[model samples]
Target: MGITREIGAHYVQEKGTTFTFWAPDAEQAEVVLHVNSKQTIPLQREAFGYWVGLAEDAKPGTRYTFKLDNDKEFPDPASQSQPDGVHEASEVISHTYNWTDQNWKNLPLEEYIIYELHVGTFSEEGTFEGIINKLPELKDLGITAIELMPIAQFPGERNWGYDGVYPFAAQNSYGGPEGLKKLVDACHKAGIAVVLDVVYNHLGPEGNYTSSFGPYFTEKYNTPWGAALNFDDAHSDHVRNFFIQNALMWLRDFKIDALRLDAVHAILDTGAKHFLQELQEHVNHLEQQLHKPFYLIAESDLNDVRLINPIENGGYGLAAQWMDDYHHAIHTVTTGETDGYYSDFGKPEHLVKTLKHSFIYNGMYSEYRKRTIGTDATANPAKQFVVCSQNHDQVGNRMLGERLTKLVSFEMLKPIAALVILSPYTPMLFMGEEYGEENPFQFFVSHSDKDLVEAVRKGRKEEFASFAWQGEAPDPQSEETFNNSKLQHSYTESEKQNQLRKFYKELIQLRKSVLKKLCKEQLEATLNEEETVLQFTHTSAGLRCVINFSDQPQTITGTQGWQLVLNSADTKWGGPGSDNYTSGVITLQPESVLVLQAKA
Candidate 1:
């Protein structure tokens, strides 16, 4: 008989419960149940290194552990709930949930205005329930989708969710599996889609006992987080299935609309069928089975077009990928910071090129990397690239985790928002960016191991050595660092913040109402001779936007028979009044943007 059961603990109404584990190197395996009393059930060794057994009394809410060859006990590698912690026993969780989003279909990729947020810091409660309370506010901001950072089970009560050791288990501190389902259900009811960020490149260093079961890691390649996952090495098929199943659990069980794969550049594989291609194939099958649309987006440093290309075109066929060049070009031009990777940027023409073409360095020489980088992504559709001015990595990776609000002027912030939202691509916003929350999104952790805590502190300091940032990097192990990163949500009280929030809402509404119907191919961008002014026009919509990037007023010619629609320098958005034009010659205010449309 073919086995179609799930890899971990699965409960069937008629079959009671069955425990399946993969321990190729072990001679014996048993499921140690911690129900009312200690009970043990021996598993029969099956083909291909799988051990299968049944515990008649095992049901949901039962805590259990696995023992191999009479050795030390360990939590299930595919555990669904690690309630106590990563080092403690795993609890059996039922995949059943009273979902109200049976009719919830995913929003089109072009209409996605994603708001990326960390669950632990997005609200004062710092739990899944807390995020549900703010859904109405997010909905009012014109946010179509909310992308959550990883929620996998990490070490302690606090983490950025990247140090997750348990790939399948939801964090116990974040109200566990039950809490996550409620958040997803609530988001769907509020007409918002949820995109979950997942890490598959490497597991955390602590409480990672998957190696005890089988060859889940390979020595053939090394990642910055240590050993790379065994994708193309020996016994790699099962390892690939393990993670592929994890992806399905989120989409199938949790009803997540999309998944953002973290750091795909670190996922190395040399096999004929690349891991990504295989994953895309499986996700496609799942989409058909579920009869609902699901997306897979990747966060890769490499500007490779193969990630979003069609499978028949010899590509991975992912839905989209994060475009960091858009952020870098805009950031460097606005901030005037030339340190580190910003060395290749800092020119106004760079942003203009990014606006016209999708990438600024498509097969061009990169001084930062000392080599030619990036493939030509000109043929890709605008929606295949997700652009953002500030994300977790761009803000939190800094020595002080200062956001753009702290670095740029108030007048400059509006133009930056205009550039991102009006650009011909899907836009994402970091948490607290709409109203410009001033708190720093610093890197933080709460590991119980003192040595690991110290190592993290030292590693953070060393990582910023190349940038030559001044003061000492904040200690990642400190609780104050975590507390300080929480969002204050004070936009309603402060005038400047409320104005900024209103400005963002208007831009988002304009994007949906005007830009959504326009053709991406009809977009045109040009830079003046001095490269201080950029003029972008959409021929299909008969709309034009001109931005001045310099501190002084810039003179630019406006199109004839065009009427002003919105101006960033208008006094309504807390800026100086808009400038006037004579005979089609307009003088733009310092660091301001003007939007105009051809009169009907």
Candidate 2:
């Protein structure tokens, strides 16, 4: 009864290709194969509102569309390849590929040092092939996992990929489904697991035809993007199956080791079994069946510990959740920005609590939300929380999309890197953050609808008005804005950036090897509010990270036999050599950090 067998177009060499669609509301359905000699084949309606037929003329590379009610023609809702456009025919793609990762095993969640990158902006080429050529660079940089932003098909070539309308199809502009598979296969060969960001809460407004096919969305609840998905509605089984099948396709067909569900807080459902739990169960089944380790990381703003709690404990059983609290606490302190949600953070105590516990607001009053929020996540493993100093949303949603490199001094950036990589939680680095690329990650989209484009432009302006940020918002519709967001690959060629990259690689090496044993039980922190100096200790591991945020040299004493393992102020790490520590005291330069291993 699993819907994965034959939901989309599947090719059988002898029988050619068979197309299947779930259109319960349609009076009639047919397949319009857009080959040189166009052929229309009437699909026999099956039980449960499914229309199925064999197109003997259709094979891999054949373009086709579904005709509903004998009148309207639209691309398959479960399209795998939209080569022309979202509005055009869905191409039949062969899943066969020369994959050499049959013996590849993905790293466990605890070992993940994830590097999140948008395929379109990670390189100048902005394609899956472009990303393949850089796999060695990421592998050599010590990245265990690569998290790609949403790659589902949208309207045009330029998009952050959140506007994806075709959940199953790979963006035609990004070289379609085959391109994504090649990238995934290549990543596995390089010993890097791939975590794809998937949006299931709501579909984009443009080129969305799922509603016409069946009850795919519900008006009972609304999401920030649009109407919420039909998870609890009356004909919701197929709707759930639609998404379940999509997730399966990515995991089973593409061999992606993990999925990062975007904004789980936005997914509205009142069902007895929440869609998240159901999806988790499905993933679990796949893991057992395929004998592969899989993970599901949720991006939730609700601060609900239940999202990652065990399934037996009446929770969603997610592998991990994004620890935005850590980012907020770090960003507020380093940049001293107290606007928006940062107002809830910025205190040394706030960061200390986040380091000790996963969430600073666990069962505490939130002034920003004007209510008590979150539950204790301290009991969860440190790896259950994915922490990052900077990500796409934190930077792209800003007025000018200024990265951490733009917000803080070169000396300040290393401490930020150390705080994240050395933390107990799983660490994720935004693309180019390792080498300190100066280019901003501005939001850009290329929607074909003129009216929708204007609406997005206006909405962005109004959204930033509340942030109280200066300067005009960049045009999301402009080619220059998209180009500006692309990372400068040549930045690492410079002496300073090359050193920073080396620093990141060394930190990653220490994390995976020596620091692997670090746990919350071994954690401790000493905060000096007056000098803005924070000393965090891993007592059991005999490790300590001393950070100086003050603008002047600060002295910290009482370290008898601690050996300086790594220092951000070292000349090798783009710093004016170490300030030097002697006896039981160490002099820390302004805006520098030091990692010391206590001698046994």
Candidate 3:
């Protein structure tokens, strides 16, 4: 029997409750229910090292733990709710919910305009309920999806969610499992899909006792977090099933529309059937059963096309993957910061390559890695690449967690927004980027262990040495650091920020109404190295965007029959408002972008 049926705590009022666990290493396993009275129930060992038992009194809200080998007690590895904490008992949760999203068919991949946000910092409440109140705002902004930073249970009240230990349980601080369901249901009603970011590379350090129950992780390979999961090692089927079921739980039970797999490059697997391929197959089956679109998007830096290719084409059949080239190219060009990976990107030609080929280093020699990198991805549709101007990793990993808004000239922000939103790919906006939220998204954690806290602080400082950033690094353990990371929501009161907000809304409106229907072949770009200008034109859509990256104004010849649609230099958008054009020639202000359309 598969571990899927026998794992976790399943409750049926009439049939009592069924509790199961995978404990091959133990001679005995017992379910210790914590209720009015502690009742110890022994589980009968089944095939494939799975143990199963029936408890007459166990029901929804029943707190319990597992006693392995009839000795040490540990929280359920398949816990549905850790209402107490990671180190405490797990509570049985009912899947029954008054879901009103029965007709909520997911949007297609090309139509996805994802807004990535950390729920803990998105609002002052920092709970799932808090995010629900803000869904209509995102929907009004033309956001089709809200990609949340992980919600899996981790230690304490603060984390980026990458350190989640219990993949099955929603964080208690975030209102637990029930709260997440309410949020998902609310999102559907608001016409916004939810994309969860899940970390499968490695579990967190604290309260991670999966190894005590079974060989969940292998020492054969080392990940940045720690040891890689035992995906291709001995008893790998159980380990793989553990995570696959977790994915299913979120999709089937929580009704999540999509999952953004974090750091697939770190998930080392050498088996003939890669874990991703198998996962895709399972998700495909689920999609067919549910009659809804289910997507698996990966965050990979290896530039491997196989990760997103169809299984029939000898690939994993993922829907899309995060493409960082566009961000790196634009960041480097706007900031002129040639350090680390940005050293390979920054040129006008590089940005042009990113626009044309979907990758800047497609089979080219990378100066930073000192090696030829990336496979050809020109055959893939633009929608297969998800581009963003800013994301958590690009911002929070910095020495000061400074956003592009802090680094680039104010005039440069609009152009960056235009390129990302109008590009022939799915575009994502980091939380608070729409209105230029000035809050720094620094790396902060809430670990209880003093020694572990100190180690994390030291490690964070050392990690920035490679970036060569100047100034003192903020302490990750400091409360001030975490407090400063919260969203201000003060952009409404500022004239410049409000204009930026309006600028983003208009671009998104244009993207959905005009750009999505434009033919990919009609897109073309011309880069002027000498003038530091870029002209991107969409012939079918009768749209042309010309940007000036230089510190001084530059003249560019516009195509015949073109008229101004939007101007980055327009005074309405807080610029010098340069809108005058001499028939076929236009002078763009320093670090400004202008959009023009052919007169119908």
Candidate 4:
């Protein structure tokens, strides 16, 4: 494990750095210098499945690729940095680069405003460098943090990144490891924190060779992706250390502020002390060392508050978790569809339950499952929950991958977005939701084997067959399907898009300005079922969110002294209002929401 430099390859490791690679398939490997082909170094292979090479010359910005068989140049399966496509060589990155945000250490989870963005669809170039162009755009729109989708190595030059092959390496297509550093550095300088979305539940299908190298997977625990990681089996310490170290690398070396672990519910670990709790403990130690506020957010569907509760209080001590119930309540009520898990939701009482308590399906009989399931979330506050109307999963799981912008009218979308930004918990916006991009975010893949591609096609079809979605599923392997899902950035120019954008910015700005008190305050909310209007009065001062769900205008009498802060009905955002509004009792139009600032 300590043999990186003897072979003359440009690799270096220090207190804050470690270089890794996998290549049992290669006879001999060399790191070819991009500047001069003559300057080459050989890599040393060890008993394990790894090849090691060390050279201090491997400074950040140095371009190189491993040469297999002393002939064909292929991207490093472990390449941390790739400024070009995966087929291209890797680039060296320096964490020693200048950082500007010395004062921006920690943003409390309770006070955070999360904006989720896909690097590819966010701009035309769709690279790490490409997103630098829009940093100010996000900051100007009142976003405090930018949560990026997965950026690890995948098969093609472009993908949704769930099917990643190299969990540690940056995506070769999106400007590799160095590209990521530049993006994070730029974000910190802009005073906007960067939160990374990391997939730890399962490794992607293509370019996967972890199993051949070591006891990386277990036959004991089976995951939907394949073999689950062996957390409890023999020689599991090293395997657990691998992922734990990866988490620390992102927070310390990459200068990442927080990590959002994807599909934590799928991580089937049965150790005495769960792996999540252990990982959290290690991260806390690292956080103390770095003296920075590092956060661990999990994507869980267990409906258990123990995941977020403090360990001293008998919980895992995570910062927050993605609130699936919040999405279920809003989506089922607005869309009026009760299929699958949505069947347990859509009831007005369910919406009220989700608002008052974090979990709606807490030990209750679910009509869809025909069983009582789920645990209570009473152990944590509202800050432990992340509320959202539409996320990548809810929108992409559909047969057509239709977004809220497509399923509902402009009026409906405005209110839905209002509900997201003005809610007590942290709010998440899908990439193009602020601009109302009508493009679908369908599932796409890039597998080299033709038969495997066909298998995926069939699997996708059968997945949706049981639900309401029935249609010709997009050929995941096809380039057309991938391109179809790529967001058309020009939609931000359309009137409806512009209005939604402005409304989002206003709502976000309002959240930043006036909702400071509610961030820490926990409260219950409800809707008058008979009036078809939903209302939330936060016991914590300064927030009251009211939405008109039915297709009729309803006025509230008792709600006086309230000034309209964010209205989706403004004409600029294509609302019915002839003139923009400043203050009034919510004359809520159909499918509209009003965010009012409580009287001081």
Q: Model 4, stretches more than 4 Å misplaced? A: 1-79, 82-94, 519-524, 529-531, 570-573, 578-587
lDDT of 2 by residue, 270-382 (tens): 88889889889999998999998889999998889889999999999999999899999999999989888778988877777888888988889999889999999888888
**Residue-wise lDDT of candidate 4 within 1-600, one digit each (tens)?**
211211112234452223345544667766676765545777677754456666555666667766667776655544566555444566666546566666768677766778887777677788899889888878877877889889888777657778776666777667777788889888888877888999888887766656554577788877877788767676565566667767877888788998999988887777777778888998888888978788889998777777888988878889989988889878887888887778777776676677676788888877777888678875567777888887778888888889987777778887778667777778888877888787888888777768777888888887786578756778777787767777786544676677667788888877777677563236657667484888887656657778888888877656667766656666666778723343454467777877766777
Q: Each prediction's Cα lDDT score?
A: 0.89, 0.89, 0.88, 0.73
Model 1 C-alpha lDDT per residue in residues 476-570, reported as the tens digit of each score: 98899999999999998999899889999999998988888544578888889988888888888788889998899988765678888888888
Candidate 3 achieves a global lDDT of 0.88
In model 2, the Cα lDDT at residue 441 comes to 97
All-Cα superposition RMSD per candidate: 1.7, 1.5, 1.4, 4.6
- CA lDDT for candidate 4: 0.73
TM-scores for the candidates: 0.98, 0.98, 0.98, 0.87
Better of 2 and 4 by TM-score: 2
Candidate 3 weakest ten by summed lDDT? 1-10
Q: Give the per-residue lDDT of model 3 (tens digit) for 43-108.
A: 999877898999988889899999988788899988989988889999988898999999998888
For residue 41, give model 1's deviation from the true position in Å: 0.5
